[model samples]
Target: MKNSNTSDNKDMEMKYVMVIETSDYLHRLEANQLNLFTQKLHNGISKLLKKFDSQILKQDDNTYIVLFDSVTNAILCALKVKSNFKYITLKFDKSIRHLKIGIAHHTNRIAAQTLSTRMCEVVKNQIVITSEVKKAYEKENRNTFINKEHIRTLNFSEEQFLTNLMNCVETIWNNSDFSIVDFSKPLKYSKSQVYRKMISLTGKPPSSFIRDFRLNRAMHLMYDRKGNITEIAQQTGFKNPSYFSKCFKDKFGVTPKTYSKQHAN
Candidate 1:
């Protein structure tokens, strides 16, 4: 791979692209807080980029586009960022709580950008490298990249199914009375079919998927300071605050109340 500092170069040289997207939780912060949060995040990530000899190509709002000359450097930097993300967030008064990072390699910048965007949409709170990057990394290292879970290559139909399922879940996410039957109705699939497909695509059953969606929604609401824990729980379809806290803690390692307090202004 060759590095070109100028975009006008017509020569084809392989480059690794990394996309970093902060969670929507950051949107809830006030302007000054958001600026501080961005600064902290940028500083933390800048150190990683320097360590890996990469450079930031662009940054817009909560998203950053980074460039790496080597696949090995890109993979190592991404893994480091993913592992240290929580600690980086803790540096901010109003933390940017989650991230979705995608890495891809291609000779063309636009193609790499598209692949990275797709990978970001499919994964959450983690780093996902395209199969191309994964192949290059393993080949160059002469060893398997042990974190197979971080590599995802989704086909068109699987992507479409995930999009449809997410839309369906969004439509009825707040309905505490929502059931598997209700969930399957809008997807135009039989309950059994939906269950099997959900497991196949997401490695989670329908009920677990629904619960995770609700918990994620609850976290967004908490960051938005939309309501108290009880109101937020009920709004996200949890029948009670205690159960909501239990589930939230189980997934996030922190109760909703504690999370809210930690991110409070």
Candidate 2:
């Protein structure tokens, strides 16, 4: 184990780590098969996180780094995805790896070193969290999956809804005054029906989708060199750059300043 953090700030600040690791299944696949399946696995989990108003921060090959909004919700999502993976893999003739995870709460104070590196190290060391989280997820799997209506009610697939949702998100991502009501207005469904349909289709409410969409777009703009953080935030519908930085840091585990520095290198 790495040195134990002795900082007093540990209790006051909340930090979390989520690791998505595949088991022995990866070793069996050919190169093409490995790339294809891994990409699909990443997209699958990425979509699930967006629905939960979270984002995958960084990824190392098959290991994904995600800063979940909360520990409980994160665990539930991991379990749901893990449970669904078996079903998804059935269609493929080639072998595919199974997804499992490690979750850890970092209470240590933010030091001068890189936050992302430390977060990854601690979580990797705590392999026990993977099994513990997996167990807890299984216990809730029945309610989480059995009751969910996997069938499409609107004669549309989740992928279709996600595509449409992204269109809406892109349209409104630059408008500061944009609201869920505004975002939903363009849908073919009724306004009242749009909310529930969106919730059912995406596993997230309209409001969360809108907000997360903006933040994500802002982050993209940052990495793309479209503009600096403040400009990117404002252009992506955030009026207050400070508030934008706070939200970005909370969801991504690093301030925009720090993130930009790392990416610039």
Candidate 3:
């Protein structure tokens, strides 16, 4: 098993996208029907690519992996597979199991099997071909996706601790109940101690770290409903709408209402 970046051809290897099983595919189909559907699925995927510069492997009965030459090719493959969710037909059956796709560029060093399982789990969580996945698939933004925000804390470089922190943060990501105190509660360190550790390691206060998270949430909610400024502020955990407005101005250099108006136009 080859890892993501370990494919040797760095210039050619953009990413490996895993097409995961998203439904109860075995619920109704007989073994022969299942085989037929799988064949159709494979042929459908191969047909999407204009130039077959990469390998498409049948990892299992249901899962497929496509190694594409570039991020554009990967995104094209992902969108193609997702679009087929509404179009694919079997020979004897009118419908088949739907699929969800997950894509990650070849940058990290993880085992191939582990990467496959993790990608499958991720694709299952994301039913759609998500905007994050789509944005990461862009040529100019591809580096930003895998590189820009990934700051590994050097002093407290414990994998389990980082994993736990990520899990806790992601679990309550959109919840207003998530705070620095809540994030520190399960870390086996006192609140102040955890604050100091994060500052020493990551060069910022824990509250400062999540400030961007909340601000980004606010921006996302703005796009969701173009005119609901106060409601978006409260939803992002800003108790004072005025203060939230100020923060938004400071970050994006535009007031929430003005930004909303611009987007609305």
- The best candidate by TM-score is 1
lDDT minimum window of 10 residues, candidate 2? 146-155
lDDT string for model 1 (77-191, tens) is 8778777777766755444466778887767888677667645644443676666677788888886663767555444565556667776776887888888997688888899
Q: Model 3: runs farther than 4 Å from truth?
A: 1-159, 171-179, 200-202
> Global CA lDDT of candidate 1, please?
0.74
User: TM-score for every candidate vs. truth?
Assistant: 0.58, 0.42, 0.42
In candidate 3, what are the lDDT values of residues 1-265, reduced to their tens digit?
7677664555345455444453334323444665676677667666765354556645555566655556666655555566775565533333334455555444442333234333343222332232334455544464544322221111123324444555665566556556677877888778887777666533557676566557766776775573488888777777789988998887665788776765552
Error of 1 at 23 (Å): 5.3
Clashes of each: 0, 0, 0
TM-score of structure candidate 2: 0.42
Return model 1's CA RMSD, one decimal: 7.0
lDDT of 1 at 5: 50
> In model 1, where do residues sit more than 4 Å from their true spots?
1-41, 47-100, 103-126, 129-150
Question: What is the lDDT, from 0 to 100, of the residue 22 in candidate 1?
Answer: 78
